[model samples]
Target: MKRLLQVLVIIFPLAVICQPNTEVYLFDLNTTGNQINITNGKNISNNEGYDNQPSFQYENTILFASTRNGQTDVVSYATNNGSKKWLTDTKQGSEYSPTSIPTTKDFSAIRLDTTGLQHLYRYRSGKSKVLLKDLKVGYHVWNSRNMLVSFVLGEPHNLIVSDLKSNLNIQVDTTIGRSLHNIPNTNLVSYIKKNKNEWEIRSLNTRSLETKKIANTVPNIEDMCWLADGSILMGKGKALYHFNPKKDTEWKIIKLFDKENFDNITRITVNKQNNKLVLVAEPETTLKPKLENIRWIAGNWKGEAFGGITEENWSEPSGGSMMATFKLIVDGKVNFYEIETISEVNNSLLLRLKHFNNELKGWETKDETVDFPLIKITKNKAIFEGMTFESIDKNNMIVYVAINQKNGATAIVPFSYTKK
Candidate 1:
């Protein structure tokens, strides 16, 4: 006898725990107390591009939306440590709303975007397909058991639902308002409305589409997201807050950040891999700046790197100290030096260090040429100020030192020389 299909119960109060490598990443902001750090918040494609929508673990595997490559697309790291790989390929416009499904796999992601104004594409399995088109999609949610999608048409935005098994679509909401998200197991949707100058968090039933008010706060709300445990997480300005629906009150503010030093918290993502949270930070709002070519004298050298190490996409950086040996032979003259640096703990963006000159003044690399602009070779010691340039297009340069303080508690800097 064959078994019949049975309906599974919707599990409520889904408890989510932090994974072993739990990490919090914000932008180049200074975090205090229980604040999560935004370490590596730059576009891997260019030196002066935007690092929008950060979503990844501490292991250097992140999924975010970027337009640095001339197109708005979803990009991910090939490994826990690797270059950014584009997931969606559209030349006309860019993509947005990139979120990763918590998994051990490095490149696993589920991103959605509506670039053409007529379709919404889901980038997965190495390709993008029209998951929902001919409709106005406002927000979407995807999990292991079910998928929730929202769309807007005419004036008001409407919510929709689709089952993965049947590929059927159903409308959930018909209100003309704002943001929406799924609250774990409960068949309800949480949304925000602009009440006066403040925003209010509310809920709507999934079955009946009846709306219910939840919380009302300041107007600083921008990117709103929820964890799998039914705890709501959202960002207003530079700080992150957690809200509890049952208690009708705000929970502990998880990662309150310093606003002056860092950028605005544009988006927040929940990476379930280690139950870690990743926040995308940039200078409140800035344009893609022109980068100069990073220049370093042509020479033979070696180095080593460690500490402040993160697994998924670089996090919890307590030690990013490095040491590198710079050996340069220019115009029959030989000069040698060393550089040591200590990266900001729990932050990969700031690697502070001291500089000590040698026989060589400095070196610069541009247009595939290593230019040593300053170098003085003496009998015993050397004085050098070197620069290395990585041309990220017609304009852009990243500058790094070739020599630094000696003995002073440091290690070899293993700069991953990505040979162009």
Candidate 2:
């Protein structure tokens, strides 16, 4: 147990603090004839905190891990009326990857306790018992009443087949991903076989222990589900793609939820009847204010602004601030100078600047300074109230400032710079 905990904490952290805020969405799926149509999409897990790993518990019920009281637990949602029921509430541990057990009313999930003991357990009416005590099962699926295939956490996670009837465990494959499901209308189970250059969806024959590649996955996407007609569905960003191994040459986009702002799509599953679909995604959020997010701006930069050559030297972030000095030169003479600082204030960022003439005459009063509070931050842009800093690459950048004109209007002026 201790060794298993060490592996889990190193490879995949189960703690609540490490999880991101996400939601689970349900959609009505229609795969009639050659085309597919998805409609009536709704967010089933709409609460705050982490909610993911969705699976169909029954024809009209969906099971997933949801956050409540600062910890994750299994929750079931009804597709008919949008109702929910908590299945497990443990104070010292959390449950994830809940799935229905074949030929039984009970379900199973992987539980991670406070002491770092991770194992798969079966949940009955109100009690639970460990299903696989020795292996730290990250995700699993039931092949039949007596057979199970699990993705066990390890140095390179292994895919194991456990027979409950004979108490036998066999390692079938290694270096696999978490998405696993029984292929419909076949005696095979599907799993992701990860490789160095690409990942492929492969099938494992439970009887012969044979494996074969089905198709290469959508680049870096591991989560997927099988339709009733043996077609596969996978989500990436805001788009859902479909692949038919028999006829399709490559994965093709079937639906795009661009207007929904449902980004980072993962962990998708379809119901047994192929009429319902559930997916997990992280919604777009405002970036938090942190100097670490914009530390790439610290360097010597030269650019052109105001019809002259401008230069700025910035200090690395320290003492809750980053300081810089800017100078503008034109016609072989120093035009003006500016002193600037971006400081941490009240849990946010505040940018302040003071302007001076070439001869050191103050343009503003002794206490007056231009201020621009931080608005948001993206992967390459740091936006303030009236100013923005955009990094094009390691050696190039652009700064856009709102400048007041003589006509009592304001215009955005761009300053392009190259790192020195």
Candidate 3:
């Protein structure tokens, strides 16, 4: 029969290429509430505005930290969108963050000029070279064979090993204090934060400058990202720890939220193509006054985003649930999202929030549009902010909240989500 139907059409396309492809995402750099959902993960290139620190350029092509066009540059993307490049641009100040050196074609950026002092630049093709000037690199990294250049310089915070072959710069001895970076390929694991800020999860050995303090108690580590099954993903205080340095410790504690009043777990990012886990839960105090605006948000909440760009899942889906219903509905202004998800393909659910200071402080959201701008409505809590567009000249700013204190503190925006 025609050679068994040509071997079942070439073995059914290799069993659909060995089954794999279902990413769906739309928020990273830390996903907060106000209806920002993504299921699966990985799909960033819309609202490329305010895009901060994303490495990897040539496969899913990326190199973020952007202000789009009004300033603060360093942009490039090609997850297949074809072209959207701008290596670096600055008529002056603004450039603050950008890191990439993982399997490298070369990348590193920092141009915070204007006296805040931070002028380190190094781009490849489009041209732009500075490397080190004035000095004060807060958090910079580049390894995986881009040569070598780790950071966290001066002012009571050392550990700045440099060496682009022979330019050497050494400064190890990380007794570590106020640091939240340096963990890209184990140069000696990092995520420090001493002097009462609490955080501990260290591992320094700048070839043996020696430093070890892996989890002396993590209540809010806020520093993670080292997974390819090597597990090191973290997020403390409220809960979520998975350390496992080859069985040297903590293998799991996954998720746990509901601590006094939230705020302390500053950041933790990891999307491993979509295993999903991005948090930024911080709120030590903003005068929540007597917050209890909607009786601890009642119930019913869910999150998962990014379902475009050829569409599949993207990365934003993995056992989802969030129930913070009603507090300030129609008669009170607007703040309602009832999302439900399931995907063999698609299940409509979009959320949006982009506020880079429309008087609402700082906010960012992108799942898929949900109208914005409402600012305040206290009784249970309701605050808003908005602004969007990643490409037409970047302009992101999304913030949302509908707090009602119990564990309540749900609407606070401060921009810092990065994924492209």
Candidate 4:
């Protein structure tokens, strides 16, 4: 079975409601004598929800699927001025894989309707009409003004070529991946053939239906784009690789973005000029929240805060929660105390704390507590919305909290603690 076929089987049931949180990034690409330089990276789709499947409409404009107004719609973004326009706003369903129809101002996309029907449609002047009916098209690329090649969903998920003028659809291959493109400076369209052991990049001549193997894909990666120089670019992890079928034997590292927030790179594309590259990726901190990630925070700590001696004792995680108690001592006497807990809530972590005076009188109401939602959890850090906990080592730690002062100003106070 193909890799995309396996993914479709799992996601098809909740395809409409369970889209992942992904963002689209744009970069300026320059290739000079086998040295590829990627710079000026920008997050074009800064929205909080699913944004992916980017394709260049022109030299300065890009089209992609974006989640907005409770549905996925087509969004056109201008690379020159950093502007955007919503091209489709349909209440019936969501759209994906927006691409410009050859030699026309209109565009085509696969719209998954709420009734579980999927088809290809063309948009002209803000109106849409069905172009290929009764075919479950997932991804497509135009071969000419009236011809296109698409990945159609089925038991095996097939590669299909549709001729609009003749009202005919031809099945070219089966068990294919989602990345499809027109081979640069050729009359052929490219598709992936998933072999049992290794996947191969293959090309199809739309006119004669002849097929030929171009090259093996980059390990398990299938998403790629062709540059004007006939080289291919693919991403894995935080690195982007380059391959030239005419000269290279294997994929070579062109650039690595280890310090950036890009992760799980997929769905890449380049403009006609080949100077701009667009890709889809999840942010580095998008991992699911788990108590095991921050288990290092469990210990006894002593430090200083608010011109006083401070001490905190944290219990190990148990019963889906970690409890802690903090005390402040000034002038050799107890000043105040706080009760805090890190609890599992809705599959994420939540930090709640309450304040009390020296005599154990509550400073806030019984139900009132300062809450901080989990933002992200890294190897040695647990970052909440307004507070952060960092472990310097096994016996040392630091906690930063946002403090509202008496003069209506807020400040970040850091407490450095050493284990007793």
Candidate 5:
């Protein structure tokens, strides 16, 4: 008699919870008829944390929010000198969307407090003042010296025009993405409108408060920029594109960076001189690691190891992750348990495990877990940082666990298991 295959279920991380770590890049921009040349490309924000939403404050400076200091804060970087400094250092909250206000020495950013309070704040002279008290601003664009348009967070997030002096907040539209920008030398600012599942880039009359569609974009983009010659450059995935509403019929790839070498290219901006183009992007991801080759290990198995009977139960891989549990039984009594997880991180696969006692109390602290990085993989055998798994057959497998004995002798303990 043979056992039937069992279908296992597990929860995937929420979209809001699992976001890619992004970094910003800079490039020189040049254009011809329908093609653009990008040269002198360099990574501006190389840290691992969220370094995104880059906005050109001057021809030589960019402001963006970064999590390098644990909590997100606005950081200023000089493009020429490679200098950096914290623009906002509030201890109680994380700040985002740092934009330099036109005609002023001050800047503005969205301060997200730990108590669930999000507000637009003005920062200048080492002081901060709340700009909007009743609305939670996610992104904003300065329309003039005293007025600006904002993407206020709500059920679907709405677009609003806020008067800086009077503090009047007026909702202009609903269901908008965060690509807000002021058209060059014009009173119109551009925004993305979510029309059902599709998105359209529209221009808003800052004075009259009217809107007109400029160009329709692919779904779910919040990053775009206005070029000097009336062209719009937008980011989608690893590729960057430019569209001219008057000449071009559709968006075309700018050939700025190779698509295969980049990931999540978004939040683009150009300097006032139109020579420097900057973009926020995550680097180096082709696809997540596939688990099909490791399917032989996805089952319940029992074996003798560590002077005890070890039972291991592994769940099928799904949603870029798999899970397993192991128990060590001595004389028909459980001695210890181990929780194991296999998931993709930073474009690579990793196996993490933690031990627990018979009473289910975790041996590892809440802040730390043992990690095993995938070093190599071949057919039915995979090698981790210091361990390896080899499958002799579908029912038989061996795990070479790296260990060091108390006598200072290093050895590999092979745990051999057969499918139950």
Candidate 6:
């Protein structure tokens, strides 16, 4: 790739949505109106170990943490070529709840270091830097670049707003849940407070730091995501629920994930496209999707990203898998190349890819290709377990690849191209 074509952008912070410790799945929304019709469900994280806490980096992109390699770091999936890549590869400790910080091209998550201390970190260009310290943040959401509302782990587990610029902490309430979210196109952030046997949904004004109760969730739900029109979607034992504070006043059962299809679910998130639902479920019960569903990725595609022209060729899905190769040419020479494969793990589609150099020497050992889980698949767009891809039309496509380098720097690589 052409090193001179690099452009940098900053993004977000980590959002520790909920800690249920389960497998994550992707659900497609078939019908969207007053209600949601989600069908063709599939598991994203098919690993035997812990895979949870998914967050959207964009409408077509997703970022999450997985313990597939015995330690927790961030990984992303691209729906376009069915490719997966590692965002954060650290030996320190595990990272969680990767959330966008707003008004930037960077993102952050909670890092529990070897000493058992939790800090909020900002990641860019394949590296990570701590944004806040000394405060054990179990969960967090940023209303802006400076103001953040977090479910902090403390003597009583308080909800506090910390001003990054002034370094002041203001407590909002106590005994709150881990689901912290930003209501779209608004300055308000929402959180759940345990109210007796039920949980109440409350809104916080980022500017004033004032709080108000807006609605309540179904009997027992700790994970939820917002729809385009400000409706709330939550998941309980076997079904999905929704509550519209603007139209209805009560929590109602709306969608269900059958025991045969999914189980032991945790954390819920919607991709930026706002058409698919993400669920964290028990790995044992998660289902696999069909290969024909992603046949759109079987072809030769070319794009410009990471300062060079990137060309990738993929085979049609067959024999339970597909194969592909990647090359980034700078000037007139190849800078880096890659080998990729897409297949099924447990019961879900899994994308694994390994990077290489100009001499065809593999960058990663023969045993590993970064793994990305399948998030959702659409006609023109598909989100793998991590990043996102958008087809403006059949002839053009856009891709975003989030990279967290081993050196502790981070970058979100952008690609643009026309079908050749």
Point to the candidate with the largest lDDT: 2
Local distance difference test, candidate 6: 0.71
User: What TM-score does candidate 4 reach?
Assistant: 0.67
**Could you give candidate 4's per-residue lDDT for residues 303-322 as a string of tens digits?**
99888999999999999999
Query: All candidates' lDDT scores?
Result: 0.42, 0.87, 0.43, 0.85, 0.77, 0.71
Using lDDT, rank the candidates from best to worst.
Answer: 2, 4, 5, 6, 3, 1
- List the candidate 4 regions with Cα displacement exceeding 4 Å: 1-14, 286-420
- TM-score, candidate number 3: 0.25
| Model 2 lDDT on a 0 to 1 scale | 0.87
Error of 4 at 325 (Å): 42
Error of 4 at 39 (Å): 0.4
TM-score of predicted model 2? 0.68
Kindly list the per-residue Cα lDDT of model 2 for residues 379-415, writing each as its tens digit: 7667787787878799998787777668664555668
Candidate 5 to truth, TM: 0.64
Candidate 6: regions farther than 4 A off: 1-21, 284-420
Q: Report the CA-based lDDT of candidate 3 relative to the real structure.
A: 0.43
Please rank every candidate by TM-score, starting with the best. 2, 4, 5, 6, 1, 3
RMSD each, Å? 19.6, 12.1, 20.7, 15.2, 19.4, 22.3
For residue 394, model 1's alpha carbon misses the true position, in angstroms, by 41
Candidate 2: segments with Cα more than 4 A from true spot: 1-8, 11-17, 286-420
Candidate 4 colliding pairs: none
Per-residue CA lDDT of model 5 for 183-214, tens digit only, reads 87788999999888688999998668899988
Error of 3 at 206 (Å): 4.6
Model 3, span 7-115: residue lDDT tens: 4334222111122221112233333432222233333434423344455544455565545455556666665454767766666555544666566576777665433
